[model samples]
Target: MAKLIKNSFSADLVRQAKFFKALSHPARLSILQYLAETKTCITGDIADELPLSRTTVNQHLKELKEVGLIVGTVEGVKTNYCLNTQAIKDFKSSAISFLEDLNIDTINCKK
Candidate 1:
């Protein structure tokens, strides 16, 4: 067994990593795009919009939900899903800061 080193990073970095991981999948991206386009809580089958199966879509939704990107509420037999605005805002801020930090005027290469 190896020791976990994830705790060594800052909380913000960890959170940003989680957000990036959740968005890394195309299915998850599509889900977010679909929700954003709908602009309302979706109680219907979200998988209908994607090429993947219901089970696969649900898994992607779980990842997004776990990362605080999406909220899923149990409404009777259906789950109402929507984007978590605050989390998205926070993610945007953190991601911009992180990306801006890497924005340099030039990069030096050594042979």
Candidate 2:
């Protein structure tokens, strides 16, 4: 038989971690919250509301898009951006279940 890798984690676990990593930035979090609250696609002007520069905002948007958190479409010169609702909901549900399944009582620690 071929040799097996020692790490217990699977590729899916690594992918989930990467998705969370995309959310670790405060700017990206703000973008997600804005999209959720609006509940509709937005085009431009959002960058002005934040302290960051337009380029920085665009970069953050690109990062969020790369992780499948948000969807963007170009209409003429304007690029509309909105949250991927299903993705967001799935992430939230999975995260809740993951957190709920933790068996903290099973740990035996001396403190």
Candidate 3:
């Protein structure tokens, strides 16, 4: 197997990649939107809010949690989930900065 070279990239780029990967899935985006709209920690079944199965939703939640975009606390039989505002803010800043740096309007590629 080829040696892993992810370490070659800057830390900010790696973190932004992780954030983008976590947001790539519609299920995960929906979960984030739901949490943001609710503005409160949810202890109930988040799966019910989406068309995906409970297991699938759980997987998406795990991805979000791994990216530090969501916070999950074990509450006995259930896990309470909430958005990590600080991380969200960081993601927003990074995404905006990265996109702004692209300056797409000035790209003169043939249409």
Best lDDT goes to which candidate?
3
- lDDT by residue for model 2 over 10-100, one digit each (tens)? 5545656777898999999998888888878898757976789999999999998998999999989889898998888877886676666
TM-scores for all predictions? 0.88, 0.83, 0.90
Cα lDDT tens digits, model 1, 1-111, are 223356776776777788999999888899999999999989978988889999999999999999999999999999999999999998999899898888565767676
Residue 16, model 1, lDDT: 77
Better of 2 and 3 by lDDT: 3
Index of the highest-TM-score prediction: 3
Off by over 4 Å in 1: 1-6
Error of 1 at 22 (Å): 0.5
In model 3, the worst 10-residue window by lDDT is 1-10
Ranking by lDDT: 3, 1, 2
Candidate 2 contains a number of clashing pairs equal to 0
| Worst lDDT 10-window in candidate 2 | 1-10
Candidate 3 clashes between residue pairs 3 or more apart in a chain or in different chains: none
Task: Report clashes for each candidate as comma-separated counts.
Answer: 0, 0, 0
- Looking at model 3, residue 102 earns an lDDT score of 80
Answer with 1 or 3, whichever has the higher TM-score: 3
